[model samples]
Target: MTAADQPPQGGRGPRRAVAAAERTRQPTEVRRRLIVDAAVPLIAERGYASVGVRDVAAAAGVSVGTVTYHFGSVQEVLSEAMVLHIERYYTALSEAAEHATTAAEALRLLVDALFTEDTDRHWRMWFEYWHAGEQGTDEAFARGQADRYAAWHRQIRALAERGVGDGEFSCDDLDGFTTRFAALADGLALQRLRQAPPLTTQEARHHLNRFIERELTPRSPL
Candidate 1:
């Protein structure tokens, strides 16, 4: 092997040695997932630019070869990490809305969950992947991003229809409103992702809530 790819000689790189044994003991699929999971926080904290395969391997408690064995390159691993992380985000939004009887309550739960401290890492990870994939060189990443956007738009449209049914929201053009709202949320999320960002999470939610009140929610009778 090339000197650059050589495993760390003396010290365990980032994670503990005891966990190394457990990391390798799992089935192939499980080990692959472990590597993806390790990459997410590393990407979130370090940014995709700074994190290398070696960093991921150390974090995953696996040898560099093990990570390469499962994923051909670091980009592939990071891409999968984005996929898994985003899937959980969508699932969380669904779960948050499940308890809400009114359309307004469902929206409040989704917006609250979307911009929380816990989800800050998630937004970071997403922006990192988005920056990397925006050039369209990564075909798989491009396709996945398109699919994810479509899914998000669908959810927004569904909620808008439900709002109409519950008499909580009204919009002359549901499709146009859905697009505008999705873009608004995306902009707010990017603002929140900035380092030392001026936009606080609460402020992001407040802006979104305000949009709902003005654009979607029906005003009281005069």
Candidate 2:
């Protein structure tokens, strides 16, 4: 039912009270999600420096107080949003990993997902965070970058092992492979984010595939 259908609390009768209570419960969950969804793109697109508390509340269709009551600060709201984003990212990675039959396939899937068209918001948000962190004014931004990189490093390491096992890669230095691969993804994203036309999803996939192939190819028949 719509908001108008819900009974008012302490305004009419017991039914109104019950309806109001139910409505309140429903919105608590919903408002939180709305706040997060609104905050993500705003902070990502505009950067935290340019946006304000009122803007977020307005975007979410809530008041400034409601935003403060739920998250206390813009930093807190942004931090929680990053957490949610990473959780979704990891879940998608897990599913891709499960469906992959070979290490090459798994590695390709991981890179493809990293450079996926769906990740534009992520790339933008992450780029903003990196810029903020380098400014030295936001410790949270710096820590968030480090934490995300660590998580990606772990995933890449696992995928690297699988690639080696399937003879898709010749690298014995799995740690080195993971670190460099993760760095390559980040570097390319940063470059493309600043370049013209942006990098197409297929172009990203091709670049990643070629890089992997080059790394895995053996020199001669030694």
Candidate 3:
């Protein structure tokens, strides 16, 4: 049945009416941004693969028509949501780096921020994007993955450069370390986020810290 045709179950009113009632009056731009923002939690909870236009619309407290009116397709909404979600991830790391006086301090803060209390959901959306790219299922997902990976690589490389400049960290192959470290973090996050007790966040961080100590620590002057 159509949204309007559904009867109120359990006396809470119909889903459509509830959605309409929950969303207060807002400007068009704000509503559009809210729609994108609303998709983030849904993606985290349900996985991006299971989130559809109807899901986004319901999560945003808007109608399916409204969602389509703002976006060309659900794919567009998903792609934008991916970008929005990653902004916080990058921003936290950047802030950690910016606020620190030393590269070592910055690295410690970055790792702490990386393995946050809520990292499971955050990493779920990311791995979903990565799987989409690997499967060649979505062109937009593939393109966005490439762009985001480039940014991630640059962020890691920039930190390495800062370490080298400060004489705190040493790396013979800056580019290689940047790529490998990113991959390593990704792998660790995936492990921690997975079910069946793959690994704990503490173990993951310990492993990553050991890697940093071995690879990035400056050598003694000979």
RMSD of each: 6.1, 5.7, 5.1
How are the candidates ranked when ordered by lDDT, highest leading? 1, 3, 2
| Candidate 3 structure quality by residue, lDDT tens digits, 16-94 | 5666655546677887899999998887888767899999998887789889988988877877787788877788779
Task: List TM-scores for all candidates, in order.
Answer: 0.84, 0.75, 0.83
Q: CA lDDT, every prediction?
A: 0.83, 0.73, 0.80
Highest TM-score, which number? 1
Residues 1-119, candidate 2: write the lDDT tens digits: 89887766766566545744654676576777878888877877787578778888878766687788878688777766666676677778868886999777787778778876678
Instruction: Give the 10-residue window scoring lowest on summed lDDT in candidate 1.
Output: 11-20
Candidate 1 lands at a TM-score of 0.84
Name every residue pair that clashes in candidate 2: none
Residue 176, model 2: lDDT of 74
Put down candidate 1 lDDT per residue, 65-143, tens digits, no spaces.
8999999888899889878888888987987787789878888888898888888888888788678787448877899
